[model samples]
Target: MSIQSFKFSLQTLRKEGGISQLSYGIRVFIALCGAMALSWGINQIDMVIPLFLGIIASALAETEDGWQGRVRALLITLVLFIITAFGVRLLMPYPWVFGISIALVAFCLSMCGALGRRYGVMAQATLILAVYTMIGLNQATHEMPIWYEPVLLSFGALWYGILSVIWAALFAHVTLRQALTSLYIEIGLYLKLKSKFFPLPTRGAVDSLRLDLAQQHGQVVVALNRVREILVSRIDSNPTNPRLGRYIRFYFIAQGIHERASSSHYNYSDLAETFFHSDILFRLQRQLSEAGTSCRKIGEAIHGGHAIDLRDSEETVAGVLRSIDYLEREAEPTQWRLFRSLRQLTDNVIALQQELDKARQLEDISLSDASQQIPQPRVTFRSILSQIADQLTPKSQVFRHAVRMSLALSCGYAIIQNMNLSVGYWVMLTTLFVCLPTFGSTRKRLYERIAGTVIGLVAAWALITLFPVEVIQLVIAVTAGVVFFLSRNNRYVLATAAITLMVVCCFNQVSDGYDVIWPRLIDTLIGSIISWLAVFFILPDWSHRQLPMTFAEGLRRSADYLRELMRFYQEDNVSEQVYRHSRRRAYNADALLTSTLVSMQQEPGHFRRDTELWQRLVIRSHTLFNYIAAFSAHRGTLIEQPSNQLLADAGNYIVESLQEVAQCLEQKQLVTDSSAEFERLRNTLEDCPSDDDERHYFVQSQLQSLLGQLEEIRRLTLELQVQVHGEHIKDVK
Candidate 1:
């Protein structure tokens, strides 16, 4: 490659986290190579297999933590590895004891998820190491010391841990940078998806777009949460660092940008219908599209470690202003309300642009009142105990998963013992990797594992035939391992294939590797079937089962958000912390509901009861959230007027209606008719004198829109109740 092209390629890799993945692959490669070299130098080739397995398990247990945290984790992991390995060796002689022990270990390890993600990962790796101990013991060439496998495994884990700590020290900020980059990119994509709604469309098309928007918003929420976690961890470690402070501010700015970008002031269909012949809608669409581009550019800047220019965003804002001005000058008095809504949208976009500018010069930006330090969860012993105690029930998904995994592993072990398969531990290992907490995820892994194993077996046969030399196979094994680490997260199929190939090659070094192909395929198939059956039959946590609670939570959070915004309207000021917290919680709940609905669709047909009705509820709930956000976006001082009590009453009625609907859904009761009260509020609004100011008009229009959305949501909730429960406490009007 030419020098300039090579430079561009490196930059692209760094931006997209290809470099980080490559670095991880390289680390694994080095660990594998070092282990092999040490084994060969000492003429202890039997130790190579266990050492390699240990290194892989250690890498799997790794999480994104700072160097100090990683060091601490590494020590704990080594202790766990030694204990697990030695325990397996102790129980290996008795089949019944081994089977029961393995099941109990599986249960305890799986329950570690209740502690947190980091502990869960370490627990899984430890379980895998337990199986590795069995494999290593079976592969023993001669009688050896009882301490051999455990000692070597601990050494291997410690070696990998040291490498990880060194790497973390060198590249501490890279992960944070990548996470922020992804956050902005997702936000930009969300904006682009939202822009599609501005054009006139049919009702079906609008609902479809809304579903897509909600799903995309979920992705943005995921990215935001990841960035927040990393920032919180880093800041807690070194609170005085200026650079870390700047990143925190940038995160706050992104949150502000997302809130403004996601705000909807009025119904898109109404706006499109009213401004169909005018360019105002088209102008707004272009402005949104360009603002999305600006967000992406900001992401690029963050990734590339450069300053961004706001010239394009400035121009986009100016064009939007001109469109609004033209619309105001040409529109008649009756069109003022729609025009005012359009103005609110324009102002939101302008505010978004200003946040983008803040991202450009983060060094000079002062922290806003809303930019408080993200709270970190307490890690005390009491808190940890409480967290785990809460999940130790049949209702908790984690508890169900732990029970399922233990039973499945025990069954696999029994099959292995009864069938007299020499390489039967592969079945248990396969079960360990393929089984997950959810059916959809477990099913997905099952398919990928089977497909990948078949492909890897075929490829391994060809490679064994073409390159018969042992050293060549060894090199291929290490390379396959590197490829596995690189693609593990995004390309599970490819990763699975690579790992399978690596296992075949490594086995060939110690024995007839060709003999492993058929057993590998058979074990994979058996393990996958077991996992699928386990998820389907054992405490199946179907996504549809979660619909009632998820939907209720979404409505409740939306109500809380609306209540907060009403407080803002009345008091003319609300604590930024409180307001933002409410906004975040509402968005998070909505995102969860959207994501749950998606998972529900992936479930079996029979389990998806009232699918269409559930979808409508999701769309309507999201619409209600949008109206509340619109009111929040236009927060300002209101003049005392005759309609003030009417407005307050309207807000109170809407909030109470939402809360009541949520309660009814949760309780499986009927929703009472609110049409009369809704109608009275609308009549009062019409009779109230119209304020000349556009803000007043915008607020009134938003209240009207919220009332309409709440009514629709109530109707959908009642229908859903009827469909799911067959009867209700009372009938609706």
Candidate 2:
């Protein structure tokens, strides 16, 4: 990884002391202290029951929900945890019965993530509950009745659940602001990464920058989604909520700024060739870098709740504009088109700065004046259930993973039971944690887990040998638990190591820890091997099988956005609600494709036989979305609505062509070139009245530019189809 990438990864892991981090840390500390106090107060440190409950509750409390939702969800999970704990004990005497039952439960719980993020969290918590219960069974003593442990576990879970709700009630706004701050941080990083793509610094740098850009863009999309989810939930519950209205508007401004900031004006390679030695190109690069720095400053200010200096970015924009003017005059006649492109790029940067200014001023606006509803998908119980049903199919990736996990875990359980290893549950536990959705991820996790485990074991051994103090060991265990919670998402290897140390520490609280090390390592190896074998042999669904459908879905959504734009243009009374919804869907689809393509890259090389082609298709689809966004922005700015007959007709034709492209991709049909209709649309643009209204002329010019972009989309899609279908069709135009 580059230094910048490493820094980005580190920042993501540490969370940089935002309000969210503070809240999370507080909650974790509360859980720890509460659990430890109760355990000591009751004088039952043998079971370490409080520790289990506290850890489970703290881990599962990562829900972006309101107080009511968090409480309700936590209660539901508690019930499930109790049931699993008792049920596992009841079936422990019958190894075969227990194995099969556990396998089925694992399958169902793992598949729950297919529903949505909330359900995904529930699924993971349930899985952890199951593992915790099984481990308890392995350590079960004849002194305690079966119900005793289950009931005690439920108390721990309930206590943590109550604490979570209290935290939510007290710091809901802090959580929301923290989420928004994260979105801004990612946007800043994305902008900074994008700045590196300019001036085509070098061939080597270009590829690295592009990869970083793609990664950062994906992160930005994920952050934006979370922010939108939180805001939408608030607004949906109360549409006229003033605070939500202001925040939603601010989010929209950031979204708009990001759209413009990341939009591709011209090919970077083309820019390198056209203005290789031009001082203006370097000036533009510096301006972009400064803009990115300004974005980071704004993010920091937001995170810290401090005042922002808006004039700094404005001055940078002014300097960039002056540089553009100087270059425009210095350019020879041959460089006029290149100069125009450079000016347009600078204009986008300036627009982004203006949006940033507006965002900073958003606090002054009244809620009644801002858009009330946040753009998002309908998130209801019914919708989530329907999503679950839709994915419960043989073709679904989630289904395949669920089945794979069930089989792998069952095998691990059988091996452990038959061998009668001292810590047999560790084998199943390692298998459960190592197995991921994709084969590539599973393999990658295997390496990380093994390395992390060895390092953690060595660290634990050294600490115990050197200090040999119970209090210090307990503190180390608690610290490991805290770090595990904070670092799991961005630093999985570190989390694994910390969690391993935590488990060892907890074990030491009850029994001898001296003999646990070698067994843990051996069991981990067995589990990792089982997981790999199962994923590779059992109904493995490679990403190659799903890429076409994802590509088609992206194209279909782009077409929908185009049709919405046409409606907005023709009606001349654009409903912000409808336009925003369509745009959101399009952007979501693009993000989905980008994420899938990145996953596809991680799959086995043989499965990615046409990796280059798939990448081009994704790049083309992204470019298509950018053009559609530009069209939307340009159309929104027109003072006098241009005659929409030609534009509407053109939009309809383009939509139809895009739909055909999607169908061709999905059905493996030959792609027919749609250049003729695009040309006709261009020809019809001449009919737009070139009167004194400069805005009208600007709209005309934008439409012309949009058409050219559409033509590029058509060409790229046809090329992709030809590559996939292995057949080329003669051009009709």
Write the residue-wise lDDT of candidate 1 on 1-733 in tens digits: 1223423533454433732676688789999999989988888766778888899999999877777788888988998999899998888889999898988999988998998778999999999998888878876767778899888988888888999989988877777777777777777777777777777568899889888888888988887887887775665555455666677777888887888777888777787877777777776777677777777777778777887866776887788788788888898666765776777777887887888888887783332322354666678889878888899999898999999999999999999889987788888899999998877788888889888888888888899789998778878888888888888776788888998898888888788888889988988888898999999999998999988889989989998998888887678557877877888899899999998898889888898888999898898888778778777667876777777777888888888888888888776678877789888888887676656866667777888888888888878877777777775355544
lDDT of 2 at 555: 86
Using lDDT, give the best candidate's number.
1
Could you tell me how far off, in angstroms, the CA of residue 234 lies in candidate 2 after the best superposition? 4.1
Q: TM-score for all predictions?
A: 0.94, 0.88
lDDT for residue 187 in candidate 1, whole number 0-100? 79
lDDT of 2 by residue, 1-733 (tens): 2337635643853464433665665666667667766666788775564356435643564577767667777877877777777887688789889888978998888788797677777777767666676777676544567677667667767776777778877765566777777777677777776676666778666545655565666777887888787775555444455766667776787788778765776556776677776766666666666666666656666666787676766877788888778777687676765555566677778888888887677663454556545544666889877887998988888888889888888898889878998887788888877888778888999988898888878877777777667667767777777776676665678878887887777677777666788888898899889988887788885777778888889889989988887665556677878877787788888888888888778877878757876776676667567667666654553444446455566667778877887887776776676667677778888676646554355445556656675677667666666666564444333
Q: Point out where model 2 deviates above 4 Å.
A: 1-22, 196-212, 234-246, 265-283, 321-347, 364-371, 375-384, 637-644, 674-733
Model 2, backbone clash pairs (residues 3+ apart or across chains), number: 0
